[model samples]
Target chain A: MRAWESNIRKVVPYVPGEQPKGDRLIKLNTNENPYPPAPGVAEALKHMDIDRFRKYPDPTASDLVHALAEYYGVGDDQVFVGVGSDDVIAMSFLTFFNSEKPVLFPDVSYSFYKVWADLFAIPYETPALDANFCIHPEDYYRENGGVIFPNPNAPTGLLLSLEAVEDMIRHNQDVVVIVDEAYIDFGGKSALELIKKYENLLVVQTFSKSRSMAGMRIGFAIGHPDLIKALNDVKYSYNSYTMNMPSLILGTETVKDDVYFKETVQKIIDTREWSKTRLTELGFTFPDSMSNFIFASHNRVSAKELFEALKKQQIYVRYFDQPRLSNYLRISIGTREEMEALFAFLEKYLAQ
Target chain B: MRAWESNIRKVVPYVPGEQPKGDRLIKLNTNENPYPPAPGVAEALKHMDIDRFRKYPDPTASDLVHALAEYYGVGDDQVFVGVGSDDVIAMSFLTFFNSEKPVLFPDVSYSFYKVWADLFAIPYETPALDANFCIHPEDYYRENGGVIFPNPNAPTGLLLSLEAVEDMIRHNQDVVVIVDEAYIDFGGKSALELIKKYENLLVVQTFSKSRSMAGMRIGFAIGHPDLIKALNDVKYSYNSYTMNMPSLILGTETVKDDVYFKETVQKIIDTREWSKTRLTELGFTFPDSMSNFIFASHNRVSAKELFEALKKQQIYVRYFDQPRLSNYLRISIGTREEMEALFAFLEKYLAQ
Candidate 1:
């Protein structure tokens, strides 16, 4: 029975990682920053005018967009904000990936990419990453409708060079090329500086990772004027108030306080390096991750066994049950104390 | 030259009401609640833990959904929430309006309806309202892919009876029928109670009006489990974190405080009655309004001239430059003091 459902909308929804309740767990499933947001976030939330809820927020989110433009040294028209990177990327797909040729992406990129393609009825193909889980520049040189891939790609956390990104943009000059930089602040360089040269390039980023505001749900895109116009066109038609009051006000503060942002991101990178050494001692191997999470597989014990064992002790880490990632776990870097607890538990289990 | 644009996404975007800054105006253009949200809203903002922002919000919005479900006397799965009514309605078009047959709606209704149809490439037809600016049940008796219209329909605050709504559903049981009740709390009856008897009925309401949380951006749909399931499937496929922390927490508190909600709604309704009497004495005529706004036309003055004159005095009311509604102004019921000022201005202009 159709039951009032559209034939076009019978989609298998993208499953977000578990957000467990009890505070007892050392959660490392989703790649969230361990530190709190900038000091201004608390001040902003505290000083928020609750009375203003009677009126609507500015539909265009001009203040935040201007702040982003200023911070990135770009024109005001270059910036577009949304609920999250998920929202930005989803809108980008709707606006750009509509030609007859199939858009090309990595087979093992963020799972939501394929979901958006299927939902929008856009044809797509996934060129698999190499054996080391690295994106090959040559793979994206072919003709396509559009191209999108996460920089410092998720789970594996491998960063392709800025030079390689330039090659992909230059080759796909006829199509829109999106550089999803959701995890850029932790280590990898940003593609924002290249937006001036590549009119077809769109760089997408989120406050959920480095700025520690995943609960706030703020994300943005930096691109050329014409491409951004197309995005704004579709977004306005879809929903005018995509960015709410809290996001618009608080997100501006996040961009304004760049000193605190640098400190938080540097601290996370420090913790990640320390965890790398600890995991090696425990007989787990992973790539030199540039993002907030590390994708590792145990050399001795199966990843499934380790994932289950960690959950038993209330130390949660993500385990993909698919073919390629079935043997690995994507573990978000936490505070030093939380990482210690994870190592202590693994030490016991490995000894057994 | 299309300039790297998608042929499918060349949309003429919907233009929302102007949100003017620098508070020199008495704004009644959009049907936003004139009062602040519940008292608990301010306290909630003050006490929100900033540290929790590092983590993502609950994707399902369980607490808020549960509160709405409990309030409406429906199962949890029977409720669906989104960023705003615009978001909910847009998703409904994408999720439910599938068949090749054109969906039917009011020829003079909320302008966003036609915009959504154009954006999604869904075929739609606007059946003409009767000369009295009231919906005729017989107009919707024919076949359609789906149907949607606001209760106490916008720009003309006249309502069709519950029986009329049921008639549309009864006639179109094969498709979904949406009764958008954005201003129902002001005077009109809710169709939420009819959900139990009619699986095809989806009642959409918003916190932006009676609840006074437009800045918070919360709206919901009440329907049978299957219809609600269809909404969720598309929502999850689009963006998981549509509702953020502030919206979820504040919206939940709004539902819990029934006393405040009743008081605010009653206050608005009382003001609406008072405004009706004053306008009658001034030679202005209108229908018996069942919503917060009054659709009025003066016997002597041109709507265009009045609209321009009000703008000069920093008093704003909605004026559509379209057929049938071109002669009328949609004035939202403001506080007694604000309404008194509007009356003073009009009285002076008429004496001239």
Candidate 2:
């Protein structure tokens, strides 16, 4: 190692899902929305004057923030915008998880949670999920520096009820509680409704999953004004211009088209429901997920074998090699034709 | 105060130059490029497929990174891109400045350096600049965690000699030395050539000032492969997809047209030279600037009064209220016509 390497802040980075190049595959590993973004997004981008790009973007991102605040019926101060939910949550970890006590979250949750905690040198403890891959509210009731977990949680795609989410928040009122709602728009009710009541609660959502703008990189948090102010303080101190021009303009355009937003979400939900029935008939058992992805384990074939076989056919799905999760595969809900292709490949491979 | 507020990472955020709304105003505060970006940037955006935005942007920003590396004649592994240079330098600070010893820079350098230090809890000491607002190589010869200073330093626009920069880097070989070349394209030569000799040196540049893409938020750092890898690791840990799709694509296009890039830069340089003569004729004095902006203090009028007087007429320039900078006004070079309007206004105002 080099002498200067000794002072380097070493970190094991969170490996994102593979963005395989070329368009011949049924890409499903990353739980991205199968539909395009709101049509207004395309219209907005087409007419955007690139000349204005010579100037710096609005650092406050007021237009997008106001759009989100109006859509969610919160005050403008109650929202914070970032590159994505990853950026927003990472900033939250830095801003609110500064106490000496260990922050708490579910073991089976968005994997980035632990990475952010480690990167920031914040002590954290992951309480194991119950046998059914469900988060127990009582597990988070203990005293901690802060709390955070994804709703309609990743891999399992199971969601905690609003009351349970509130129960955890009420118990941990002394510390900040972040509800990562990346997958909330699929079917789950957002914890945003509870923000007015809980000063320490922050509900984060993204345009990546349901809004079909992952490539655009927009995410936001709706919380009490105090939490929002603190997040902004740290964000500005770090980088004043985190959200660029196109994102600010196009993200605002996204919020204006509620019809397209709802229709796209419903289509994914419909596809997911249809997929669950087909998976059950094929001898798969898994949680009844509310998110845009389904997690399943076949009755006979090992998930590893299935994962490799599917990869050979270019029908990609997420398979965690970690303990307990090795048996399951998380399949994102794609278009009907794409799902049919995946099912066709699976039926033939399993029979063999 | 709320009990949870104690855990909040409270910080005094850096205030950026005001981007006053309205096109009627002549904006010259932020040192942004005076011209639009390469024509290819518009062509690329016009043909972009918004449908592809449903997927996540490339986490590595490979196309843009490779393009930059090829353009700069560096290996692909030696390049790191981010939302802007602020994001790039912020990540560098997080990745490389983790030692217990205090990092060192000129006291009058980019104000954001101190803000990043405070935000990350990295101890830093700012040595005083010389009477001429120039960095002395010997002042940075002592022990510290790291060193960073802008070339053609901000709000002063005074360029340090390449030999002086190399001397400082040679002395601080034990720790990372960052030469922020934000305004390097305007006149000063980059320290990038020295990277082959010094593995500890990192050169950061931004398209915001020269390539005319501040709104698109494109910035990059070129250094040794190891340093680049360390920056990527910390960046991934912070936010996997810092550069969104449009920025990745548009930034790549901006790099392809070298002719347009050079012409735009030369235009700004010519304007700066012309403006300097005019400002001198009007009884303003400043360091010999090798940047897109000139930092000048009027002989008789107070900078605050001039700043306010200019703002009333819709011509904006930056004025610092802090000690030492209170008398100085940093005026960014705009188009020749815009500069003419500014001179027209100033000629009468100064005479009065």
**Best candidate per DockQ, number?**
2
Q: Could you give candidate 1's per-residue lDDT for residues A1-352 as a string of tens digits?
A: 7445543367886776788988888989998889898999889988888888899999999999999999989888989999999999999998898798999999988989899998888999999998999899899999899999999897799998999989888898888999999998888989888988988999999999998999999999999998888889999998999888988999999888889999888888999999999999999999889999999999989999999999999999999999789999999999989999999989988999
In candidate 1, stretches whose alpha carbon ends up further than 4 angstroms from where it belongs are A2-8, B6-8
Model 2 chain B weakest lDDT span, ten residues long: B10-19
For candidate 1, give the lDDT of residue A222. 95
- lDDT assessment of candidate 1: 0.90
Per-residue accuracy of model 2 over B1-352 as CA lDDT, tens digit each: 8889989997996676698999799999998888998999999999999999999999999999999999999999999999899999999999999999999989998999999999999999999988888788899898899999999798788998899999999899899999999999989989999999999999999989899999998899999999999998888888899999999999999999999999888888998999999999999999999999999999999999999999999999998999899999999999999999999999899989
Judge candidate 2 at residue A256 and give its lDDT: 94
Q: lDDT of each model, Cα atoms only?
A: 0.90, 0.92
Query: What are the per-residue Cα lDDT tens digits for candidate 2 across A1-352?
Result: 7777888998996677778787899998999999999999999999999999999999999999999999999999999999999999999999999999999988988888889998999999999998999898988878899999999898789988899999999999899999999999989988988888999999999999988999999999999998999999999998899999999999999999999999989999999999999898888998999999999999999999999999988888999999999999999999999999988888887778
Alpha-carbon error at B82 in model 2, in Å? 0.6
Q: Which ten residues in a row have the lowest lDDT in candidate 1 chain A?
A: A1-10
